[model samples]
Target: MGIMKDFKSFAMRGNVVDLAVAVVIGGAFGKIIASFVNDVLMPPIGLLLGGADFSNLKVVLKAGSEAILNGDAVVTPAVAEVAIKYGSFVNTVVDFTIVAFAIFMVIKAIEKTKKKEAAKPAAPPAPSKEEVLLSEIRDILKEKQ
Candidate 1:
């Protein structure tokens, strides 16, 4: 029961909830960025690169063998193609760069706003009635002296 209460308290913490929400939103944002990169951005870039498809780009390391049965090509087994897909990696890198830059810009704008707010002079607070009475008393005492 104590452990359960502790778990509940931990789960209900503001930071924990905020982090969970951030994780969910971040996942969605990543998906949107990936779609933008793969669907929207990559198509034009691929065209500019002489119709090169990044996803299909790879370096074949091992070419799988085709089996020949009974001196005739009866059934060929599936060939395991080992390759490094750098084009997809490049796309992912671009996505990461864009996301990072966007986050940086957001943070920068927030910091700039904060600085502007801090730089503005705040109005002085009004003095209390007790402070006004004390000043009057002090002035009377000074006159008597």
Candidate 2:
């Protein structure tokens, strides 16, 4: 029960909640970015590259073959194709670059707002009644002297 209570407290903390929300939003944002790259961005680029599909672009490392079966009994297991999918990597890179740029812009905007706040000169505080009275008494003494 103590451990459960501790876990609940930890999970309900502001930073933890914020982090969880961020992760969920980040995942959704990544999906949108992925869709943008796959459906919108890649088509024009692919067309420009002579109808090359970037996702399909790969360097085959090893060839694959169908599994050998003897009367519905497996003789040998099927081998999967191994390849370096550099085009997919390129798409991922583009997505990351866009996300990074967006975050940078947001941070820049926040900084600009902070700078504006800091740049403004604060108004001086009004003198207290006691201080005003003290100053008047001092002026009177000085005049008498």
Question: Judged by lDDT, which candidate is best?
Answer: 2
For 1-145, candidate 2 gives per-residue lDDT tens digits of 9999999999999999999999999999889988988999999999999999998889999988889999999999999999999999999898999889888998999999999999999888999999999999999999999
lDDT of 1 by residue, 20-48 (tens): 99999999999999999999999999999
Q: Which parts of model 1 have CA positions greater than 4 angstroms off?
A: 65-77, 134-145
Off by over 4 Å in 2: 68-71, 74-76, 131-145
Give TM per candidate: 0.82, 0.80
**Model 1: ten consecutive residues of lowest lDDT:** 68-77
Q: List clashing residue pairs in candidate 1.
A: none
Each model's lDDT = 0.91, 0.94
Give one clash count per candidate, in the order shown.
0, 0
